[model samples]
Target: MHRHSDAEPDWDSLRERIIGLGEHSIHKSYYPELQDRLAELERFRALLDQTSDAIFLIDAETGLLIDTNESAWLQLGYNRERLMRIPFCNLIAPASLAWFLEFFASGQNRARREQVTVAGLMTADGCEVPVEITIRFVTFGDERYAVAVARDISERIRTERELRIKESAFESSTNGILIADLEGLLIYANPALLRMFDYEGVHRIQEKSITDLFSCADTDTRLLARLYREGAFAGEGHGRRNGGSVFDVHLSGSIVRNDSGQPLCIVGICMDITERKQMEELKREAYEQLRKNIEQFAILGDHIRNPLQVIVGIAEMIDDPLTAKILNQSERINDIITELDRGWVESESVRRYLKRRERPEASFAKIFRNQNNPE
Candidate 1:
């Protein structure tokens, strides 16, 4: 063995060099730098795992899955090794596989640089998970890769379906429906509303103020005020059509609010009451005519009775042979007059019955008038 120096070699510096930590050590190693890089990779992976989105890296040429994030394997219920062994197309639901293949084969994804699509991703348990996928093509040295970021959209799909159903209901409803901004400008008018107002299309009515649809000058003002104060309003009012013709309508409206309970817009429903109003008017006229007829019948009966009385007095004053015949005929005429009086009484009874029947309707009308006039 060679003789050692009197001073011992620096043990601490030697130890640091052995572990890849010291400078100017002939025995230096890269272990510490390698550890730092490994730690950075672990942190990046942890970040990807924490996200709700599944990320996949695929070989563009072979369509094989090269790597994936934790969400990808966890969401698909597959182990990392098995998921990497499977082809990317195998992960897509059968219904979406053909389109996905065509999308890649046709170079559409590369041409677009980035493309977004909604499809189903098959799970390990034979179930399908709806996903909205955004794909981008990239290259690294000699390898072309596809970067796919898929977000589970089951809730979004369900919400969209519900919205479609509501839209259908709004379109198919019989009652006219309208949506307006807080400024009273019409934004949406359903088919029924367009037809009710004799408009051919929604464009004919959109952006028009609600006041333009009502014959009452103050209708929109009062309606907005009530909606602001009470959040709702309901009553009967007159509507103006495209041709300036007016008709009755029962209007119900309320403020539409958002999740924060802040008013976003206004919604209104309109029911045409023109026919009902016409029928009520006709009934009122018929009742008035019947009342007049009853009065005329009573007056006619009284006139006939007075004439008969005069004839009876003249017959009683005379003693000629024709007087008995006149008295007998007069008695017959009196009997006929009595029959007329009986009919007059029956007519009066009928008039009273009709009046009683009309009382409730009259009271309702009175109430409505009071509401409108407010005296």
Candidate 2:
């Protein structure tokens, strides 16, 4: 039983050993509380290494890595052995290191979260990573260090670039573009669409219905309903600009969807067709004009033809020789009269040359006068 009791903890010796280690680490004159605090920090560091943050301690003077957390190995593409050998700045992109060095060299304590555009990485295979860094300054003993935290922001940066490309395409598109949310609240409009409605900016167009710009609002409502239900709509509609001038436009609407296939927004395009509409109206007016002209010619032909036939019959019925001669001449006259009908020939020329009523053809009158006068 006494031999078994010897196996129990020697609490006094254990306490003395811990106290002796603390004295070795600090001066013998150092307060016990200060020594105790240093011990607590070592225990806290062991716990901090297990976290997901890419944590590292950077020496204040040289920015060399003194220690790193487990997350640094995964986030920075490095294993512990490789990371431990590198300066903290060696893992950072050159441009970013310059910016960071400025802050560190200032000697003023600082903390910030920043997007570093370029970053070098350290991998188990001796490769490097580009990352966004967030850091805070901390003091250990008499020395200062920075606790740098990092994350791989490559995906976020790629998304941002894609957004800029889409924006550029929308801005430069030729079609008149208008974008509205699911509630039909206008959120954006391209330059072509603004010029279409004579709106100077998107502000003037916000919250206004697609119907508001239309000369026919009821038609626009039906069109919008079809677009929502059918996912697309295309038809001609009339629109009025700021000056109250109306024009024909073909409106096309399309529904925008998200990755989940949920309806996100409505995009509309307006294509002008004013000249085509004007041409159609002009054609309709031309057909009516042609009809009226044909009717007038039909009536004129009936009036002129009927009177000439009766005059021709009376001239044939005459009996006396002189009267018969006159009738025969009159019959000849009727032929010219028919030929002169409807201003087709000059009327004054017919009067002077053919009628012979105290007037005669100039050539005939001259020859006869010379024969009869004999002077």
Candidate 3:
């Protein structure tokens, strides 16, 4: 195979020609070392291609891009060819650039993994992407090159932000969240958790044990131990709030694991059922009050409605025109007052009554009927 000594030799045809014309006559660029080295490069390149993490090389001088993979193209929102020419510092946040330059300019120790936090890599639409970059500094034949492995934490970041938002919300939340270890040692509790424990705030709940916090700790411990071992445990448990006041909690819990699949922590989410649980105790007191109000209303209805009924009956019995007219007017007024007191007057009926100079008795009754049953 023939290759230009100064240029990138196109070996595509050389492979084909070698198969057809035989290797003996040709001065092939493909030697044993060259072939082995080329194969090694191909395998390494394939490994880089297969990696989900975005990998790219940058020039140390101006922080200019040197080359990048397909993931870098999609991630930084630039074509590989376009990215090669741009200054790497341009993608970083202005506040961080000086710090980054200072950090980078320090003599690089080759083959060391370094983590750098940089904000805002520019996209095609002028939007910036936040990236956490891990750079591996290397010197390739006296030319400085840094291989960067970047993960698009955008989703992870968003989830984290949402989780933070959720956490912040949880901190100030009405609901309580308590975190403990496998041995039932308390690690964390939100303000709401502290509040549920009625310890004033989060600081008070700290250093307090479930054993100390609970009155029925002896009975609950065995069940709780079983729950931590079991995945996705949920049940009812008795919890003691501050001041030695005991309360019930509808407790739900799960085991927390790290990347290596080892159990690191346990988080228990709880709903305070103390108020709802005391429905049985408060039942008699509440019923007594409600019963009183109902009886009073019934008595008032009887006292008011019966008199109006008698007046109407007597008005019919009267034959004298003036006497009958006055009795009828009083009976109608009584009915209107009763409906108004019972919270039965509706807006439309009131509007019509206000619009009319004198609402006729029959028209008023019709309006009341409409108010009583609106369809």
TM-score leaderboard ranking: 1, 2, 3
lDDT of 3 at 25: 24
The C-alpha lDDT values of all candidates are: 0.84, 0.68, 0.67
Judged by whole-model lDDT over C-alpha atoms, candidate 3 comes out at 0.67
Residue 34, candidate 3: Cα error in Å is 0.8
Mind giving the per-residue lDDT tens digits that candidate 2 earns over 152-179?
6667778989999988887887767888
Model 2, global lDDT: 0.68
> What TM-score would every model get versus the actual structure?
0.73, 0.58, 0.53
Q: Score residue 336 of candidate 1 by CA lDDT.
A: 85
Clashing pairs in 1: none
Off by over 4 Å in 3: 1-30, 93-95, 104-115, 180-185, 195-212, 216-375
Better of 2 and 3 by TM-score: 2
Q: Give the lDDT ranking, best first.
A: 1, 2, 3
Worst lDDT run of 10 residues, candidate 2, spans: 359-368
Most TM-score-accurate candidate: 1
Let me know the TM-score candidate 1 reaches against the reference structure. 0.73
Q: List the residue pairs that clash in candidate 2.
A: 121-128, 121-129
